[model samples]
Target: MNWTWFHKLGSPKWFFLWSKSYALPLFFLGSVALVVGLIWGLAFTPADYLQGNSFRIIYIHVPVAILAQSCYLGLGFSGLIFLIWQMKIAPIFIQSIAPIGAVMALIALVSGAVWGKPTWGTWWVWDARLTSVLVLFLLYMGIIGLKNALDDVALANKSVAVIGAVGLINLPIIKYSVIWWNTLHQGATFTLTEKPAMAAEMWIPLLISVIGMYCLVASLVLWRMQSIILEREHRSNWVKQEVMNNGF
Candidate 1:
């Protein structure tokens, strides 16, 4: 089998050239999808019989919550690749993604709290799922703090990679917390094999929002990875020449 393409992913110059073309298009499509989804869900879709407008927060909350967990999964995978294969781009991927994931986790928690207020009668709860999500946010912050504390690039990369890899255990706990314990949080709204629990009017917009969020995250990650590559590879002639030509 051909492993050449996979190996080229390790080259900062190659990745930068490849990703530069994708960032803008992804951002554009993501913005359009997100806007369309939010408007359709908030204004057009009928409100829930029980939760009313408050339930609409699901459009934003579910997608970001999903992304929060997914980003960590990606982070852990990149960390493992870095540790095992010493891929140069893997650590950069981790560094670029950590803060974004942290923000997503924060948004999920806050949106969940806002949605909970009208439905659950409170802003916060010590439910298993909620607590586990909080832990996920803290894990992101910890990785960021750990990276910042170390001045040595190599040491910082190794330390954060180890932490990111070890943090994978939390992902399963977060996913199963609603089932493993009696939690106020509800079960999954949308599943792959089974139909969505909600009406098509509701779930369709949600599906759009999730796809938009994923695209936006991808665009942001690519843009960030490009910047980090420039920062790390600035001493190389390709980086210097590219920067000079592009004026970035």
Candidate 2:
């Protein structure tokens, strides 16, 4: 019924001011949650009957993997918004998120490989899921590379939006890889429709860790977005006034 707040987010001034309210709080909360969850998962939880202590890596691996996929989906959605609505904030979303998504993909890959070492007897593989994920990583890199390589900001944003939009195809492939084909990687850890196969002591910390990671990602994205907004809007009157009065 009310699209007022939605359009308000399109304003760099409003969004930047609004973000200041939550960004630091999220940073502190996310850091605390991540620390507590990692400590609990790594030290307190009992080892898996099958995988033993090695399963502890799951605490980090799964959350980053989830973030990797989820972030791209958000990127694609932002791309759509930019392309259709010509929303100014949309490109800022891509600029802010692309690097973070790439880092998350890298974390997922390295952690997955480490997890694979004991489970699959190798550090890497050409398996479908792994390859698809690598492609996702490249997609993020492509967005970053495309943006940086272009001389024109508008053109760069448009081109990267197309790439980000097209890359949405990989999300489903990465998601269903283990189910679609036989793979060394394990299946879903927890799903809403089905009870988790893990014990409370295990999945509870993992759930907390995932939330923490999301919070951290939000903090980073907002921070980056704020930086971009300031730089892009530096020539605007509000920014000039802010710098003159606030000493920023």
Taken over the whole model, the C-alpha lDDT of each candidate is: 0.89, 0.86
Tens-digit lDDT track of model 1 for 70-98 = 89999999898899999889999999999
How much does candidate 1 score in TM-score?
A: 0.96
Residue pairs with clashing backbones, model 1: none
Writing each residue's lDDT as its tens digit, candidate 2 over 167-243 gives: 77556765576446656555678798998989999999999899999999999999999889999999999888777
Runs in model 2 deviating more than 4 A are 173-184
lDDT value, candidate 2, whole model: 0.86
lDDT for model 1, on a 0 to 1 scale? 0.89
In candidate 1, which residue ranges exceed 4 Å CA deviation?
174-179
* Top-lDDT candidate index: 1
- Mark the 10 consecutive residues where model 2 has the least summed lDDT: 177-186
lDDT score for residue 217 of model 1 = 97
Q: Considering only N, C-alpha and C atoms within 3 Å, which residue pairs clash in candidate 2?
A: none
